[model samples]
Target: MNDLPFLQHFIVLPVLLPLLAGALLIPVKQSRYSLKFACSVTSTILLWVLAAVLLAMADGGYWPDGIGVYLASNWAAPFGIALLVDRLTALMLLLTATIALAVLVFSARRWDRVGIQFHTLFQFLLMGLNGAFLTNDLFNLFVFFEVMLAASYGLVLHGYNLHRIRAGMQYIAINLVASFMFLIGVALIYAASGTLNLTDLGARVALLGNEDTWLLSIGVCVLGLAFLTKGAMWPLGFWLPGTYASASAPVAAMLVLMTKVGVYAVLRVWLAVFGNDAGALAGFGFTALTIGGMATLFFGAIGMLASQDGGRMAGYGAIISSGTLLAVIGQAGGPVLASGLYYLLGSTLAMAAFMLLVELTERIRPPGAALIAITMEAFAIEDKPEDPVGQGIPGTLAFLGLSFAACALVISGMPPLSGFVAKFSLFHALLEVSPTEGKVPGLTWGFIALVIVGGLAAIIALMRLGVRIFWASGDIAPPRLQFSEAAPVTALVALCVMLTLQAGTVFDYLDRTVAGLAQVTTYSERVLGEPPVMRSPQRGLER
Candidate 1:
């Protein structure tokens, strides 16, 4: 598949198809929503299939360094916009498409009615997400970032109320500042190195002398802050719980993938320009990434324990997932990064599924039962017997209970799920350090402890949510759940189960991904073309 010349053309389809679909959707009347829905869904399904093919192409070795590039114009790097796809990029595309499909199906029942042009915005969001994963330059990355954020601004406020309005405003304000910082950082990097192309920047950054090193460092740090803000790191992330809590269920699920996008940016850019070739500039900012990851995890743990609502708790779970990935990236080793990648997949699916389930389970709970359940669990009250769960249970009750349990198992890293496998792999990777290496750092211990405590906190919070939704709510009749609503949640949870069953295969794939990302020189060379690189002299030093 990788050797097929004709298949290389499909690299541009992921971006182009969604873009064309979104443009077409704009003219359809709201009265013609069925047409809009059909177009949106069919495009997404085709996207999911296309992404699966690309994932296979990359894994089968599409090009040197396992990266396939599509030049938007005939011009080469630092001139024309370039889109590069590798195993990691392909993995994200598939993940984004999966979640988008589920969210679209889940929203079909009612939330689509909240506003005009909902499907239009949804397709554009997919376009932005696919473009972000595929782009190979900083400036193009920013353009896609704005596209995604712009679509989200509308989606977040779809069913406008006072709460949604306030949350959406905060989301908009923070991202605008982040966008400003991203632009400034790009300007600084270009001014120092004479290019905005990622591969060009990578090559030039390595050649930079002491004169431009500090400026490059400052620019990279500024970029990191913007991405960290998007990833929901501590101090900058206090708005996440409220934003997710107030969002409609499917929108919140989309936000779940959005959080991971920030983490993905940090992972790609940091390692690319700062890899082994960067000379004294190598390994810059990793310490800060570690410390920040710990702080974010600690903050998430406290927030999880304190949360009473399911939406808010799921928000904190995303914070914890981001924190874990950031910390693993800070470790900067193949084994640990492989583990973290698997963890990212499982936690993302589980959290998104849980967010969807929250809307349905709320149907069964009394208005104040979460608080009451918390009090009862804290005090160990004995009045409530276990609800009969296994046999003769109403089908609706049974479905919600099992789905919620699967989510808890995955999020909390409990036995018999992919979450457990992820954490165990992490622990093993941390312990399996080569004999040539020094004693384990305290930061490693700190990360281990944080993972443990974070998992415990999730267990408590989600367990309490379970008690409230299923046990304390007593004998309420099942709320009406549409097939569209139930199927999406079922599909997502089932994916986690599949991950657990196929853990070995998934881990091998992730390991190859980690290995591919380490080839920084190859990445730069392939994107820049086969000739000897024309050096970019340092700019603005004389000015």
Candidate 2:
């Protein structure tokens, strides 16, 4: 381990770098917008680089157990705070950094200038995201969750537009409730298990008596609800579309990962603390998760079809991705879970790019034309000659149209894109499990149907929107494209394409990640410095 003492320190940098950067930018005057922008861009790029290195180090070839634990102040687990850098955590950090960097680059054009302290809030958001992904204790997770949410509150309302403020209020209200529930759940878990360290909690869970088990189960349910709310699972996610649509393009893009953080928390806590070894607690909320995920999928699909606004459609797409991941995870199959991870990555990139592309496309269209056209189409009215005509640079229309089409294909999971590969991989994984072996459950068919039908719904919605904006109406002008704005979208889409090109390598890494998640013994030994104790047979629990 001492062979790379520096890597141990790298684990904390994802949190510390952003924290310090955000704090330092707070005192900078508005006149130094250039300085703030430069600092934010540099910090995000460096964070992405650092995350990439950490991910590489944590890969199974370098760290076969897939854990790189860091104890602050040289402390040990279950007593002091720990920063665990497993493959999953490292992957999340990398994803966060990648999206942050792209969003920051996209924001540099003008969005950052619309509001003061934008850079500071953005950095704080990164700090919170990194902290949440890295923290090993439940209380610290709450702390980081709050940090992320607080920064998001500012970002959602950054421009202070009337619509943004209205949506931000609703977003803030919902998340506050979720936070309260999270606190209550954490308190209950700590009360029942006498610990909040995840690995320690896992070790202790199997040994809990009937009463403690009952309390812990309640705590787990409450915690899952909190996470599901943040994940935008159906009923709890009503605020997501409005909130995302109201934010600035880059801010909306960064907000894509916020839902994923909730999903990550559920996956981490469920598998680590209440996995198969938790006896009666085993598969505690699988039924709820599976059903809720399907419901979320159905809701998002319908929402996407109903959405006239591009940003809102992207929001629904995110919800659909979250639902897909949640349902796959609930199934508890290795190959399917791995495919879900891939799907999560692809969908997030595509959604972020879509959010950015929405603004660019909207810039080229005549103001109010989209809404008017949608209304007219809904009412089956003919277009009037007096309708506004869009005007702009010659090639801008084609560029915007192509970018919009690419985003549409991606969001709709169409062919020759990363989205298609991701969905195909997921479907393939699900089908690979033999019905003869009884691994194919009833929910499997439901999940498969949702995945297929949701994609079809997205395709229809996007095509309709695209045709109205690009071809059906003559109210579009060429949009003015800047390198700062255009490059990020291009880069994001390119990254997705890269994922498709390198699907084999990416799937291999995901397979290793899934294997690492199943290594309960290795994880327990690493975190606790000893093997986990088995429950007594008289306790009516089995591993």
Candidate 3:
């Protein structure tokens, strides 16, 4: 085994480096070169840490130790702070890091235009993201969440506009409430289980029978609500669209990764501490997940239709996609697992591209506008009369159209796209559920609705917005697209293309990832006993 000291360094560096860099950036904010170099270096180092940790995991031959390295004091877990990395956590960490780097690069010009402080917030936000992914304790999770939220508050209001301030406040307030509930839920879980180490909680949960089950169930339900709110599930995600729409492009891109953290936590907590515990809580099962997922889908689709702004519409569509992924998890068996993970990958890539598009189109004038607004100080031109002969359609509009089309293909689950691959696995998994297994009735109908409505909503919404924004007779002119902005969006689209071209390879990787999920006993075995034998193949599958 690798030395514990080395692992501790790996576990802590990703979080600490960003915080240190962010603190250092505050003093040098006046230097543009320093700000740019600092953000780039911080992001690169974090990515390197992510790669190093994954490499270490591989070298160790996939250590399933539920509790990873402890703190400087080397205190025992549940009593001392520690970091944990499992397959799900690792996946999310890499996802956050990759997206973080992309967003930082996308924001280079915006940082130069606005202020260097945005990078400061971005780095701090990343610190929080990394902390959240790595922490083994629930309370630590809440702390990291607050760190992220604090950073987000500044970033959301970076432009210091009326709409942004209002949106940012609402977002912050809503999350604050969720944060409180999150802490309360953690306390309740700790009280009921007498430990906060997630791995230990799983073990304790397996020991608990029907005696204190009601309390356990309620605790899980409360925790689930907090996570769902973060995940942007229906009813609780009311603030997501408005806030995301109002935020700057780079900020919006980073925000998208936050929801995935919530989802990852939900999945981990659900499987670990409350796996199929029928006696624990009422209304806290796959059935609830299915119901919630469906509700989120309906609400998101409606919200998307109601939206006039393309950014807000895309935000709602993101919520809709999240709901679908969660719902598939509820129907978990085989294909559902495959679909949920695969769909997430697809959506992450697409959302990054769409966020860039939204930024590019936010300022373009109509077909007859005579000049461009150079900065917030130039906003007086909002009332300027257009030179009817001089204005022409903005090239940025064409870029938006292309981006929206790409998003449509992914979100709608069109063929030869990552989204399609994800949905196909999920729908097939649902269909493959044996009727004899006593599954809920009309499951297939639910899956059918998911594919049909999700596809239609994505397509119709994209078409409507594209036509109004890009081709309508009175549509606004597109904004200027800089190389910095265009490059990231193009690279993201290229990733989508690569995903499409290498569909088989992507699916295979997804299968491996899901397979990692299947080996839940691996963690427990490392802690308590020999690992359980996994069946080589399912009886339901034919040769």
Candidate 4:
């Protein structure tokens, strides 16, 4: 297929459109809610459409190695800013746009009115996310990261309640420290390698001497710490539940993708720069990642079991997903990485849907129900007052209940859903140990046990919470739910069902994505506009 003029510019639009729209929105009167909604929705829909087209083109083999590299301002890479789109990048963009559209639609129903500049902040957030996914330069990655963080600060504090304020403060402080570390890491990398372009850094990293290699490793480790913090891995993740639970539902749903940005960064930078082609630097942090990932999984599992609040349970679910991806990616094996990609998609969708459902379910709960339930349990009251036995469940309550159950199934990795398929694929990949690709020491068994236990923990947590929310409460009036509110949650859950039906096709695409990611040579050549000088031929994990 010939290169279309507009398609050539498609890569930039994801970042540019949102930025322009957000800036344009700043001057608009706050009273013009309809205009703001129209503009935000239009931009998000366009982004989704553009992302879909880009994904198709990249996956359909429109460019070399399924990569579409766009140099900003016609300047070449490693000197000028570059936007590189491959299958993985396109997939992230699509996820971001899809979720953004859903959350925006949900917010428009009423949540947008609670906060000033909600629409504008949302667009800026999209711009940041798209830029982070698309940028090939490290500095630009930092810029986009800050943009994302900045917008998140506003959204987190949206509605301005005491709980939101407290959570937002903690969120801001921790991330500010992370931002500092990120800047330090970027400076160290640039100082050592004389380049900030990811592919150029990848190429140059291969030729580093022992001293330079150690320095770069330090820098990478620092950078990894920052990503880990943002990804909410283990100890760094304590703040996520509170922050997420405090945000309004739409904002909380959108925040599901925030951790993914960190995961994507780790995957992109680690594979491209310190991959096997990095010679002595190969497998620099592999052990740490493996151990850390397992620990994260365990931590998230414990948190899930301990959490009484539904929002916090969903937060732990996100942590568990992040841990699973980290472990698989740490192994650096193609099949496992492919499986991780699938799990990433399924878990993210489930968590987003779960977040939305949390709000809807909570709305229907009787006032002071938690306190009342605690008192009843404390007193060992067996015969609580029961509502009329034959009363039919309200339509809204029934819908929320069904949606809540489906989300629980997905999050718990129950059978006959995408979550089950994802977990099964991951476990299968982990067990398929090959002679050429040795397993991480002590990782195989531990990871398997952790995954199973985590699933069980999630099941227990979700079921307990579900029973409390749905059955234990008595004679509660159903909250009025708008179709707009319910529609997005239903759509997200239905997408998970669709993912189950199309698992085979999705896995095939992921296989291709993993293959492309493993090709350090092709990635470097395409991004740097030159072949790397010190390419290594070794493959698979090194002992």
Residue pairs whose backbone atoms clash in candidate 4: none
Model 1 Cα lDDT, one tens digit per residue, 429-495: 9877622356777788888999999999999999999998888877787766778888899999999
Best by lDDT: 1
- Per-residue CA lDDT of model 4 for 1-543, tens digit only, reads 333545667889999999999999999988899999999999999999999999998999787899988878767788888899999999999999888888988776477876689999999999999999999998999999999999999998887666678889999999999999999999888878889999889889978887877788888888888999999888888889898877877888888899989989999999998788888888878777878888999999999999998888888998888888888778888998988888888888889988888877876677687578557555442321122222233587788888888888888888878878888988888778533456544568788789889899999999999898878888777777666777888899899899899999999999999999989889878877722223246842211
Task: For residues 370-467, write the lDDT of model 3, one tens digit per residue.
Answer: 23323533553222112123223356566666767887788778876777776776667666673556764585577569667867777788778777
Give candidate 1's whole-model lDDT: 0.86
Off by over 4 Å in 4: 1-3, 368-394, 434-441, 530-543
Please provide TM-scores, in order, for all candidate models, with all chains considered together.
Answer: 0.92, 0.92, 0.85, 0.92
Candidate 4, TM-score vs. the true structure?
Answer: 0.92
Runs in model 3 with CA error above 4 Å?
A: 3-8, 31-37, 45-49, 52-72, 112-116, 209-211, 276-284, 367-400, 437-440, 473-479, 527-543
Q: Global lDDT of each model?
A: 0.86, 0.84, 0.70, 0.85
Report RMSD (Å) for each prediction in the order shown.
7.6, 7.5, 7.9, 7.8
Write one digit per residue (lDDT tens) for candidate 2, span 1-543. Answer: 445545568989999999999999999997787999999989998999989988988984555477887777666678888888888888988999888988988777477876679899999999999999999899999999999999999888876756777788999999999999999999999889999999889888989999999899999889888998999998988989998888888889988999999999998888887678877787777777878889999999999999998889999989988888899878777898898898888889889988988887776577676578557545543211121233444577776777777777777789888788888888888888737565676777888899888999999999988887788767554666667777788888888889889999999999989988977767877876622224486864222
Candidate 3: lDDT over CA atoms?
0.70
In candidate 3, clashing pairs total 5
